[model samples]
Target: MSPVLTYVLLVIVMLIWGLNVVALKLLVEAFAPVTMQAVRIFVAGVSLFIVLYFLKDLRWLNKKEWGYTLLATVFGVVGHHSFLALGLAQTSASNAALILGMLPLTTSVLAMIFLHDRMTWLRLLGICCGFIGVAFVVLQNNGGLGTISTGDLFILLAMASQAFSFILIKKVTATLSAGEMTAVMLLAGSVMLFAFSLWVEPHGLDTFSQGSWWIWLVFFASAIIATALGHVLFNMGINKIGAGQAAVFNNLVPFFALVSAFLFLGEPLLLSQIFGFIFIATGVLLGTGYVDEKLKRANLMVHSQSKPPVSIHDQIEAQGQHKAKSDSV
Candidate 1:
């Protein structure tokens, strides 16, 4: 796909993910968090399987690929979804959105460590800004460091797990297609999540039948659109661009989620959240190298413009000088 189209698709994925946060919040409020996520992911996995099978793209993994896929599944699907659902159960979708916006910074840090990516001073500053932004949202209720909510902590963990998973996905994508890896990971992780939910919330399965038609609709939308298609497109973007570059698009999620939460869930838009988003957006732009790339381009333009254009006469004179020097030699 063209770069422009890839970027547009990435933006669309972010929008879906942002709205899905609100959808998840609604589902978790009506059902058990882990159980709902397990079922939702199972649906997504099955959908992907059918699509892949029809496309003749589904294939078995070797032992090495299985190892990487399983690890990626643990962090990306099970860990991320488990914590995200649990977090949204206690925290407002707005707060969770802002916290999750730190994904770009977190992914960059992981990439620097695992992939030996360079880290500049600007990126370090961006990381600080991201943390401060998250703090603003996470601590908005308590107004102090000591009283951070468990939900916010869970959200942070979810962000970290997802970021780390991107690094693993990057590694595994060398040997496996993003779609195949994502399908396997989702299916495998859903099983683990189902088991965990059964152990913790034995009656959780019963709540599924209690949801109304609209709730089930939201559940299916979140699964098929947000989880399955979203990840597939996102991983494709990651394959085209690097993980860190793809992650920078996550900055849009907080804005989309904040608006959706307010409009749909009746969550208030707090002043602190506005400020938090500003910081997070700035951080993502800087931390993920977007700003740096722009600045480099700007610098090149300035440097190119700084030099006076050589006249025709000057060019001829230069050529004459060069010829004279060659004759003298």
Candidate 2:
């Protein structure tokens, strides 16, 4: 696929994900948070399984791989979604989106610490700025740090949990395909959340009114569109243009979320949120190595002095000729 098409798909992925926050906001009004999350994960897992089954590409993970998969499921599915659902119940969807925008920054820091990924001074500054942005959004002109709501705190922790799970993801990549990994994690998460809902919010599933089909609509839509389909498009985009370029598109999530919230939910736009988003986006760009002026200049200089880009076909022919010459020797 062309880069243009890949990026367009990425934009669609962000749009679906942004709207997912709105769906969660609506769903949580009628369903208990844990119950809602459990249902969503169940639906997403089943949907992915069906897609992979028809493609004949699904692979069952072995016992050793399941061990790492279980750890990732705990962090990514259980911990992250638990905190996210709890946070959304207390915070506005718009606020949740803005706070969640710090995900890439959190992932960068965790990768640096755990994976020993290279980090420059610029990245350090970006990390600091990202935290400051989160503070600004959390505090929201309340004049002190005490104003940060419980919801915002939960969202922060949720981001951290997701980030930590990313660290584990690298370890499991060799053992599982992306689809297999996601399916397992979602299945595990669904089981865990379902059990939690039964234990803590037993009456939740019973409380759904007969006429509120809209709630189920939103729930299934989020599962199919945002979670399952979004992951497929995201992986395809990464394959087409590479992960680094694909990641840059993630900054659009909050922008789309803010727009959807304002238009659909009639949420107010706050000056602090705009400022916070700016800093957060800037921080992500720098922290993720997507926008470093020095690196760009260095790359430009190298490209300027290097040979022209080579096509795969041409490279293959050149390699064949070189092998032929070596055979004669």
Q: What is the C-alpha local distance difference test score of each model?
A: 0.89, 0.85
Q: lDDT for model 1, on a 0 to 1 scale?
A: 0.89
TM-score to native of every candidate shown: 0.86, 0.89
Query: Candidate 1 — worst ten consecutive residues by lDDT sum?
Result: 139-148
Model 2 Cα lDDT, one tens digit per residue, 1-329: 88787888899899999999888888877778888888889899989888778867687778888888899889899889989998988888888998899998889888888889888888888988887888778997343445889988888888888888888887888767777788879988899988888988878787565327777788889999899878877988987887788888889999999999999999888878888899999899888766675587889999898978899999999999999999999
Per-residue lDDT value at 179 in model 1: 89
lDDT of 1 by residue, 1-329 (tens): 88899999999999999999999999999999999999999999998887778768788899989998999889999899999999999999999999988887888888889999888888888888888888788878744345679998999999999999989988987878888888998899999999989988899999988999999999999999998888778977987886657877888999999999999999999888899999989888878777777788899999999999999999999999999999999
Shift of residue 294 alpha carbon in model 2, Å: 8.2
Number of colliding residue pairs in model 2: 0
Error of 2 at 53 (Å): 1.6
Instruction: Provide backbone clash counts, one per model.
Output: 0, 0
Off by over 4 Å in 1: 1-8, 142-146, 235-246, 297-329
Regions more than 4 Å wrong, model 2: 141-146, 292-297, 300-329
